[model samples]
Target: MSTLTTPHRPSGAAPHRPYRPSGLTWTVLRLHRTALYVWGAALLAAVAALIWLLAAGPDARAIVGGCDASEPFPIDCGTAHWTTTARIHASGLALVSACVTFQIYAVAVWAGAALTGRELESGTARLAWTQSVTPARWLATRLAVPAVLLTAGTTLAVLLLNWTRRAGRGDLSGGWFTMNVFISSGPVAVGYALAGLALGALAGLVLRRALPAAAAALAAAYVLHEVLDGFRMSLWPAETVTGRAALQLPHGTLVLEHGAVTGAGERLSNNMACVGTDSAAALERCVERTGLTDFWTTYQPESHFWPLQLVESGLLLAVTGLAAAAAFALLRRQHS
Candidate 1:
């Protein structure tokens, strides 16, 4: 009877469950809670701004529309109303898109300084390595977690941005080819952010110092951005149109190379004779004098937006993979 008896518990007492911590994911999240919060707040702010702009768009457009019929909305159009509401809408769109496009810089800097570099520099990573976690697992968790969060946040922001863009189509300052709009409007923004993360991690591994690693990461990201932007137009095949028809190409055409085409089929860009030809009659004289059979123009239409985006994103993701692989290899070599 004594062996079969069980001890009585207090009325409020509950059965104990194991106090297991949430493991590496929780650890990483806790370690970088400030950055996580900042990122979330930033995205929320961008979305909120865009939503406001979307709602106020019609009113803004109407105010501007009531102005004089100037081709470009004059600085004094509708005086205070146009200057206040319309410019505010334009500025909001510009600001949000610019922030979204350039967020990769912040991502790279944070990833390098706080995410990986600081931990390694302070020997926290070494301590983790000595514990149950391996360096590979630690690095994987760092990259993968940030990447997932970055992708989800950026993708949502971009989708909302696209919707807002549609709502304020005519009010936009520039077309789809504009740097901020182009970069922030598609999946390429996610690729850039992930690339920033990978590049930052690699920089941290290579430098092992927070400040220098952050600088290196920023420099690397800038170089990547500039290079990709320079080559973006060349990623997909552009349509080549010849003759007078090329001069009247549609509104959104991204004119890459426009000049005179020689009878021998040579493409001459900015032929010396046509350098300052202001009038259509003068341009015709220049083309005829330059032995040019037709005015040839190579350009990308609005339709090529997706193809260019995919190509650029593919290249960026390729960079991400290479950087991540290099970081892992460097870690193995140093630790082994």
Candidate 2:
């Protein structure tokens, strides 16, 4: 044979790298490709709807606006096309809003069940550790990848939502503090998503089972959110507008409490239902019957929107940090 001996490699030549199923980041992406696809599809759908709304928004506004000022309202406009357009836009907004609102729970379930628990249950995570990847590194990669994706996706969705809301600003009737509007319109959405991911990962590390971990994570997230929602109003001080008579709060004011005030300054919130009665006599009787003198209203102005959102976002991010720290600590303990 001309060369029976093995070919000699150069002294300084690099050795061929061993094959792996995939790199860490690529593995995470590949494993959760279904979720990625779903996320992408949602974004695409929202973008498409928003683009259509932007195009149709002006025409819809004009059609509704063109109505005789004396007419009843949109119903009196009598254009089927206008009705259809408005309905479509409203439905689009509802769909997108629901997605944003539910993202926290969705992310929690996925992180708990698919991202961590399933791998642990099947011994895949142990396998990864034996393949020259440290436990911390693997866990870090898992959380980091999803965190980046969540942030990017949520940010985009919020921007798109803000744009769409602005497009329909003339017709959209709600204060900024409204739950759906508040969550979908600001950076707090990102905070909620990340918190969900961290809490889910913690749940996964603890449970090490798919269904149970997912359920636990979801319940935990819901409880935390409910608690947070309860404290939202207290995050910032409300502006009080008091007057000797019924006060006309500025448009877009988020009235926390409005009621007639007695001479002793006691706020009687339960007594205001009759103030706006169709019958003038009934309104007078209600006001006089209550012996109310001054009126006071506590509210959040439009300017308070960002302050409230930022505070709530900060609290959520703080929770995320704690959850992530717990998960890493738990993993470290187990690895040791």
Candidate 3:
């Protein structure tokens, strides 16, 4: 009975190997560890900022107002909105920038490097292709693990931001809000980060190398960010991200473009209206004298909340999702 139970196995039978990562996976894990500190720091800053904003009163803006531009780092975020280049810092405000940058340099860049990039670089991918795991699974596991965890971290950051901003406002205004484009600011970041990873891999597919792939992907994504602010700016008629009918200004109305201008009662400029002089008073006096050809309204950040948040987030997410889908398909089809 014992003999029957313990039938001799052929030498070719699978060996009783102890648990061990495939050499490729080990390389991936080793590389990913470098990103931990980056991810940790971004999340930590977000949490701390949220805590500070809640504890500190609204007047805390006063302290940060005077901060000089030695480098936006260690920026006192309390008065960040009041500063001139306010929007520039918004990306960094809720831990979004730190996490996004970390993801870009680490996960996004390294994934491209390790997946097809490293293999193609060392001339080892051909060797790896002949191993036990198929190239697709190899790529999938390596990309998926860190990506899933990263997405979670990003989502948390977004939530913290939303909480803090609401606390700062002391109430939730429900119209078109700018800050809400990122509900937590962190989610879109994570979304973009993942999109970056997928893009890096796709770049690997396209270039069949790592360094170039990573660089191409990161550069492409960044340039898109730069262009995005101006994306529908000239293209879309008015307020591509938000909509509430351009308010009627005193002389004309503030069009999306060309603020406080000479002749625009009928013509609506997009974001600006250029009046002859600086002062709203001076502009009004000119309008009274000239019999009001165009209206001139200055920029007013939306005071309304929920409506604005919904629209901006929706449009951004839609655009991001489309970009991501394309990147995902590109990654999936790399070996296909």
Q: Against the hidden reference, what TM-scores do the models get? A: 0.83, 0.84, 0.57
Best candidate per lDDT, number? 1
Task: Between candidates 2 and 3, name the one with more favorable lDDT.
Answer: 2
Q: List ranges where model 2 is wrong by over 4 Å.
A: 1-22, 60-82, 170-173, 244-246, 263-267, 273-290
Report the candidate with higher TM-score, 1 versus 3: 1
Q: What does the lDDT come to for candidate 3?
A: 0.53
Error of 1 at 14 (Å): 12
Candidate 2 per-residue lDDT, tens place, 1-336, comes to 485786788999987789867689999999889999998898788778777777777576564445565566655566655665667677777678768877999999999998999999999999999999999999999999999988998898888878887878524524577677788889889999999999999999999998999999999889978887787878999888765324566677777787777768776884554444556566567668767776777778889989999999999999999999999999999989
Compose the digit string of candidate 3's lDDT tens values, residues 10-113. 98899677997757556666655556666677568767765665565444544456455575664564346454333323433524534443454455565566
Q: Candidate 2 overall Cα lDDT vs. reference?
A: 0.82
**Which ten contiguous residues of candidate 2 have the minimum total lDDT?**
270-279
Error of 2 at 35 (Å): 1.7
The alpha-carbon lDDT assigned to residue 335 of candidate 1 equals: 85
Per-residue lDDT over 1-336 for candidate 1, one digit per residue giving the tens place of the 0 to 100 score: 356766898899998799977989999999999999999999999999888888887687564456655737666555655566757777888898888899889999998998889999999999999988999999999999999999999999999888887877533547888888899899999999999999999999999989999999999999999999888889999999766766677878888877876889887785434544557897788777778777767889999999999999999999999999999999999989
